[model samples]
Target: MADIEVTSTCEEGYTVESVINGEWELVVDALSNDGPSANEVLAADYASCYIPAFRVAADKHGYDDVGNIEVDVEADLDEDDDLVSIAFDMSVEEDLGDDEQDIVELGEDICHVHSALREELHADIAIESGV
Candidate 1:
């Protein structure tokens, strides 16, 4: 059996409803005027995966209480609306000081979504201390 499975169906227009692992449901609109588009969902998934990986990386770097982290994901698209690049602006509650870059590297290494995305699509991260 496959480790991951998702079944998606579209009854009308560009909106699709998907069932993941036969338990979770997701709704995506290709145009995204009514709801989140596919690219938006992918951005969210990357952020979600990154947060925990970042926390683990912080811990491994011997810094406790990294605190609340907020990630703003931005995707650049081409004329055909194909993704060209992604960037992450992260705000954290704790100051990482000199170890920030190392922690970021470790988090990127650990995040599954980071591994899944193409090298060109890898997020250019900027972290700000406070908030």
Candidate 2:
């Protein structure tokens, strides 16, 4: 296995400063009142993971000209148990001559983030829309 590290600092309520390396910095904010909770982190992670997976799936299905894949991830928090559930709806504009269905199916199947979240975090997930 390889090692990866990211550093994060909290400035104020529900907002965090994150750096993957010394060069890049990102400010992340949480939507809920509680602020930059684990829910927001989970949502970001899901979004990041799904896009790349979809790209790989697209390429495998001969979508050589696949462009501008968009993924929206939402994490809903359960007040009772304090669990966060995630969902992803992704769309990609591709011009695959005869492999559109294959590309879509492959993209859906290769969404490892969804499976990992379901298994690791027991998240309730719905792939609401895809194309």
Candidate 3:
């Protein structure tokens, strides 16, 4: 059996509905004008995974909490609309000072999505602390 499974179906145009683990559902529209495009969903998923991974990294680095973290993901597409690059603008409610880079690195190491993405698409991250 697979460790994870997702079933996606489309009855009509660009819209697709996905059932995850047979419990949760997600809807996406490829046109994006109707709903979120596949790229947008991928960005959201990266952010969701990175946020908690960052917190866990902070904890491992000896900080109990990093406080309300936010991430703004930017994805660039080439002429063919193929994803070319990704960037992350991250902000935290607490000051991490010099330990920030280490935490970010560890977070990337911990995030499954980060590992899953192509090497060229690994995010260029900028973090703002105490914001």
| Overall lDDT per candidate, in order of appearance | 0.92, 0.61, 0.92
Question: Who wins the TM-score comparison?
Answer: 3
Ranking according to lDDT, highest score first: 1, 3, 2
> Model 2 segments beyond 4 Å from truth?
9-16, 28-37, 95-131
lDDT at 94, model 1:
88
lDDT of 3 by residue, 22-54 (tens): 999998998886679999899889989999999
**How far in Å is the alpha carbon of 97 misplaced in model 3?**
1.1
Off by more than 4 A, model 1: none
Candidate 1 global TM-score: 0.94
Q: Is candidate 2 or 3 superior in TM-score? A: 3
Residue 120 in model 3: shift from native, Å? Answer: 0.7
Task: Please tell me which model should have the higher lDDT, number 1 or number 3.
Answer: 1
- Report the C-alpha lDDT of model 1 over 40-98, residue by residue, as the tens digit: 89999999999999999999999778989999999988998888999999998988888
- Which pairs clash in model 1? none
| Pick by lDDT: 1 or 2, better one | 1
